[model samples]
Target: MTMESAKLPDGPMSGLVASAVEYMVDAGQRNVLFLDIMRKRGDQYREHVAQTAPHVLQYAAELVIDGRKLAEPVNYALVRIVPPEGVEIDKNRRPFVVVDPRAGHGPGIGGFKADSEIGVAMKAGHPCYFIGFLPDPMPGQTIERIARAEAIFIEKVISLHPDADGKPCVIGNCQAGWAVMILASLRPELFGPLIIAGAPLAYWAGVHGKYPMRYSGGLLGGSWLTALTSDLGAGKFDGAWLVQNFENQNPSNTLWTKQYNVYSKVDTEADRYLEFERWWGGHVNLNAEEIQFIVDELFVGNNLAAGKIEMSDGRKVDLRNIRSPIVVFCSEGDNITPPQQALHWIPECYADVDEIRAYGQTIVYTVHQTVGHLGIFVSGGVAKKEHAEFSSNIDLIDILPPGLYEATFEAKGEETASSDLVVGHWVMRCEARTLDDIRAMGGNSPEDERRFATAKRVSEINLTAYQKLVQPWVKAMATPQMAEWAHKMHPLRLQYELFSSENPYMATVKSLAEKAAEERKPVSQDNPFLAFQEQMSKQIVHALDSWRDSQEAMSEALFLGIYGSPALQAAVGIDPKSTPSARREMPPEHRAMLEKRISELRSRIEDGGLREAALRALLYIGSARGMVDERSIEALRQIRDEQGGARMTLPEFKMLVREQFFILLLDQGAALAAIPNMLPDDLNVRREAFRAMRRVLSASEDITGEREKRLRQIAGMFGDAVEEGDRESNVAPFDSKAKAS
Candidate 1:
């Protein structure tokens, strides 16, 4: 071979070396850019921390009522969101109040973006109000005081929209969910419809292997650590610790995947990462008293669902007292607040479906198949679909008869029936559910409950011992200055501080990043070295995930072994042979009240006119279908708007629906037979009412099966009033003598 031929091979080697060098330079530039983004994130965190009133809400807002000025002072305040350009607010439409959870982080996760809970409500023309809190709690503040303050905020909204068609719809995300429930139970009259997303009311309820967070209290020897942490913070619990606990749940995500994603996509992911960190890093403080109550009464003791919690005013917080509809939105993939924790409270509160109807309560719950805990309120996709559907159909939910329901949503497509009636991209339906269905979701077994009961008892003992033995000395050693130092030094906060401008080392990163950006040479997507780097990252994530799973498994096993001990149960004053009481007993007065209400409803079974008859006929048809669609509700709304004298306010409509439902529930045969009696004497009026009922029933699609049979039966009962001219009805009115008997 000639020397020139050998030199040709050298040229290919040189080119390969040049490509390698280019990749190296690109990688170095990407690293600088990533570091620069982190520095910016840290700076933003510091700026957010410095703000006196910081919130992550994406909309402009005006303060309406400051809870700090309320009679029962709290750190929370209510603000009205100013709609953005091109969005119109209907003052006559029911307002929406969004309350973000105060669990460890500062507020505004519900309104973190334009496609959020607040955004959807605003897009639907409802006035929006936000309830957020300061980073620091007022001295001696408690959860009860905060709840009262929220009630006052709602009252202010009610006054502002006096002409609204319905009461304001309140949405509580995460920790705020139970807080809203407590307030709603105490002041049921103040609420309209409630949307609770990812809230854990049944704290001790969970699947054994899937949920590890529930075992933390037991593994830590029950809430004594919480007390110590609170004391260390000098009467204020650092929310950073809660954030740390959350991070600890998925070590792979926290330690590797989260940072790796931003590093890998430095060009596109920095802004999104920084925005989320702004909320995640903005740690808030809880009053020691408030956290103690939350840990002892709610988390460890699991008293909230049992109706065992009593306020300082001696009034018990019974969830069954709330008259408004309760909508629970949870997810199967939420490890933090699992479906069991969100839904087990229903069976705890009511014995069965009959009992739920007897109390005249409407409870609707939706379980998403695969969204994480934060995604329940934070994900834009979830916000657009589930939250949007709930906001648009809240009035329909409000008018639903007393029962348990499961709300399900399906994506709208070309094949969808009555697509024009759907307000958004998804169609929503509420199917009647039973308590047995909730039980099938998987809660703790009987043995598991006993173990948790023992854990609760142990927590009480440990808490009492700590209070008497260790608390006094700790309190003496704690000072406000020391607490401030501790908070500033928290690992979560230090990461931001250390990378920020405060750290002189990060000063060079910005200039380096600028130089790198100007001479940027990005690697090809199919580069072998880049692929190797991604593979290595994946291995690291897998290793961390394996470590997390092992740790969780060990922790769960240890908790179960320790808490399930027969000797420990006896030591904690629990009998091993006895069953743990999971449900609360209804008081005599409450039971008597329910009985009295049912009796009164039975007496008026034959009463009411066209509105009542229409409601009864609709309910009769709907009962056979066992589901409710949003299109049907929209048709009902249209009918209400079109009719002159027959138009009813939402509240009046809700009351009428409930009354008619109870009448049907009490006497199905008699109620159906008496429909003709409730109709007006005029043939035209009867025809109009019958046509309206048929329109609602046929809104979604053509009614068939059992529903069609029930509809035809209703038409037969209407006789010539619906068929032709002035002909007397064949079906007779209900016998007043039989009702007296």
Candidate 2:
């Protein structure tokens, strides 16, 4: 990152040698400066460690529940975020509960800065709570216990906000996302709109050569490695190993790019580098039971996506049981949890979009073009746009009829929000998206899935063998002191100790570095030798990247060759070649329920009050558009609020919206035929209801095409409700005074 200079002029040969000599002199100074900064960083690192043990959270918090006191103790606590000054918080708004991943790192990245998940929610006037864990897991604490504790924490948040508009809006980052979904499926009554960012839901999904984390299980001989590691730690696996695996995913960054960036700009980059390293180095530990379950059931088995995961009480966890609306945020640049892993669960849970709609589920997702895994949660721009928009419009997401949609954030010029006239910089619009949209992104490779299925079976065999053979011996040899020593000796942890002033040999380096700062000399941007050094550095990084790529390719080839063979497929109880699945007819009981419901709807098609008629008509308009935007919903909300007819509770209205949408889906003609039942003989009253429909349909600046045609069709269904003069001048959509009434 050096400044550019004019092209080198053709000059005398000796001049080149002189410039090289100056470049060497500058290089020597930078080397000395870098060493000094490193020593200072070591001192800072030691001080940081001394002050912040067990956990590091930027925002101050007061614990509400200590899981250790529970019947099944975990090293987790539910805390309330105390928003700093200048942030407005509304206790009446839906509570936001953010859970950071327990995957190797300390908690609080969700709100470590002013522009974060919690930060965005609080900015939108939400009461924010966080689920943070201590450094060590409680003895024998399992992922199931943690999941239950998280649910309890959410329940407490919901109890504190009983007067809020809806249930708590839950956010789960990375590995925490699956736990969030588990809680939602188990206790769907306690949650609201869910936001799961960069979490791997479909663990066995990925296009070949694109995502290789799934392949590591088979390559490493399955979950035995997890068992061995856990046994070595004396029933508590050090999380630094997890952190090292993540770093190994991209060697260029871990070994070259990140360090080079710091070294090249050590003068300004030290503070930022140290800040990130603090979180990276503060590793937590998981109990043997927890890691084993994670690997056996989730990462290796991929059972969550299959709805085959079972709790200790024998209750099966099904994603389709989750009644809350879900908004998934993923990035194409995220190698860890690509869009495939983040969103493929939708297709796994539902055979088609109609099934999703039949179950009354709303799912919306946005795929960022380029942002790494952590960037999905920690990037300020993502927080400002996607997270902010989600908080402000989550209530609207709840009212949306069952369907799949892709939400897009469009940059806006100065415009007022629905309330308080706050100038907004983004307009979020929901676009019509189908299941195929997700399938394409999911890489839809049945062949790859077959290989993973083999791996899962093989892992089960290996894990059982290890537990019966090697595990007992390993556990016998493992002691508390040995475990502690192993954790300290981990390469990820050892780096900190190597630089720490706690070591007696390097005590004088601090004073030496501080004094060297005074003699700092930076190299010229255009020095010939500096250019040569940068070129060589790039070449080395490229070589390492190439080597990593070749290794992965070889591993993948071996994995496919082994697991894709006919013999292994037979061993795993599968055909080597994938066959098309035959669709079965609906079960008799389920079919009976569907038939009875359809018969009931048909019988009552013409028998409801005008209130039903209005709701049915409104739902029709929303469905015809193939998408719903914030503007449309805001208009509908105002209309519902201002109607002069019989009023209904919010929950009652929600049920009506869902039922009418389904009735329309059942038979569009029958649903339209029943619109007159919703209107009375009084012409003026009919006109007002139609006017409400007109306003809701035209919530945007304008409405045209199929929506306009549908409006005319509905107007014709109203018979004489539309007068000749009314047809000539349609109601203006966004007139403030009209909306206010």
Candidate 3:
């Protein structure tokens, strides 16, 4: 080729540069379009708010308290939510305490509406009390103080509901989840079943590409920024910063669609958007010390999962120490708190599921497939379903034998279904799970742990340097006026600013928009713009997804590179050590009794013959599946009558059967094949039996791949036997045998 041809118009280098420029211009244009639409939507949102301000103000005014007339400033004071007229508290019912999270948001979310956790408890004939705080914390309020106040509140709730079997059932959401755990550990006697929703305990455990939020602290140079932020806030960190982080997790929803949703469907979605904003925009503050402790001891340090976190008096905050059943609610799709973060703590803190059971600690976790973080608490559909089931079944969970179980819910229309089916007609069963099963979801490894440990060390150095050199200057310069200004000017705070009278054109547009909506002129569902907006929103979402993926890759690479190095690996040992003993200090009598029970269980298993174990396992499966069938129940009744009139209660009988199931699972073989239809065809009973079988398998110690192989072999034998019977080739042979006889 000639030089002229190669160097002429649109040359090779120019072509590449031009392509880059074109791509940038296209992206810029799309962003500008999105911003313009969002701004217009923002204006519309403000207008709608202005129109509804009067009615909302009136409703809010009804509950307003005069600042000068506030009660004594103790965090733990007896408080009651005055039930509305015609709604009476059930004096005889158990009491419930709903603790709302102060993480970047105000209180009342636990009871934000009528169909909520509080509402469900109320409908279930339980006395309900909500633990909410003011929009601001008291000066110098510490987390320890809050914990003490909660304990006091529980005492009052207990005294009020004297006849209840257990103390008030505490429901803690998000940040409050940890707070509740702390309270429970310090004063275990003041609590009942503890429900922690969307909480992260095993903060260091998560899947490789699924949880990117955990890497943000290390990526941002550790906890120094947290200290700097707190110092900037005049020793009280603004919670809006935390809220802003949450918003950034999903930019499209927070930046564009959140407002667009109201503009496009202004008439229908306006109330919901405003109601949620009322809670979301009201940010609270945490003491600098509290934030630092959370960062060093929980998030960056991952000390809580390691059983190293200690209080001022040096009492360890061992989650395993709490005697109450812990019901962990998390979601598979929650990037903020994934299933691994919520669940891996069990295996990390203990050796096996049996160890957990041996401690008499019942843990039941329900992992939703696709609900995001806030949906665990906010979505009415979710609250009505999941929360409702949990509240109704606390008794069942409380009594369930110790083991790792995955709680599942299935919708049913019939009333005569399994006992796991609750009022809403959803059948819930606890499936047995193994450590390997739990490990499959966790991305934890030696390298990841080492990197986290390094992060912890770096955080300590950063914190010390700031405290020694920079903190005094920051506190001296940051006045209360400056802190207040900072809070108001935060980007997260501006969500409330636009709706205020600060906008000049708000009034006229407000009237016009309200009139337009009232006149029945609104955007149709089929409107081209609405469809276009959704499509564009999805594209933005995809862009955010790409960004998240890139960040996750870098994080994983950094972790592996830092921890996988020979020097670092030698410095920090990350491989998990041998399982720890479960000999927790307790009353001598109780300990001895527990040991004796374990010994007896072992003795029984050893003495029982393999045939007896197999037969018992088959019978147990029959009992489980039998609960679903009328005929099976009849057979059980017949056996009971013939075997000298029933002796054990149903629960006791079920327990006996389960013991046999585990014994059989320990020695798996063709003998197990003798029992046919172990899992019945009836959907309800089959599910129950499957769950029961899992419980037995999880409780056993000798379970391994050999047991699984034997089960397969047994299944194969049964299949072969069925096939042989089906074939018709041996009739002449049978006839010849009969003639010879």
Candidate 3 regions off by >4 Å? 1-78, 81-90, 415-422, 518-534, 555-741
List clashing residue pairs in candidate 3: none
> Candidate 1 residues 632-689, lDDT tens each?
8997787777865746788988888888988888889888888888887888788777
User: Residues 174-280, candidate 3, lDDT per residue (tens digit)?
Assistant: 88888898788789878778889998887877767668788777767679889889988888888888898898777768776787676555445656776676666
> Evaluated with TM-score, which candidate comes out highest?
1
The regions of model 1 sitting more than 4 angstroms off are 1-19, 724-741
lDDT: worst 10-residue window of model 2: 414-423
Q: How far is candidate 2 from the true structure (C-alpha RMSD, Å)?
A: 4.6
Stretches of candidate 2 exceeding 4 Å from the true structure: 1-26, 40-53, 414-423, 442-444, 577-611, 638-652, 680-685, 718-725, 730-741
Q: Write the per-residue lDDT of candidate 2 for residues 488-565, one digit (tens) a residue.
A: 788876667777677675666656556657776666788788888889889989988998898888888998888888
Error of 1 at 91 (Å): 0.8
Ranking by TM-score: 1, 2, 3
Instruction: Tell me the lDDT of model 1 at 662.
Output: 86
- Angstrom error of the Cα, residue 92, model 2: value is 1.7
The CA lDDT at 528 in model 1 is 70
lDDT (0 to 1) per candidate: 0.88, 0.79, 0.62
What is the RMSD of candidate 1? 5.3
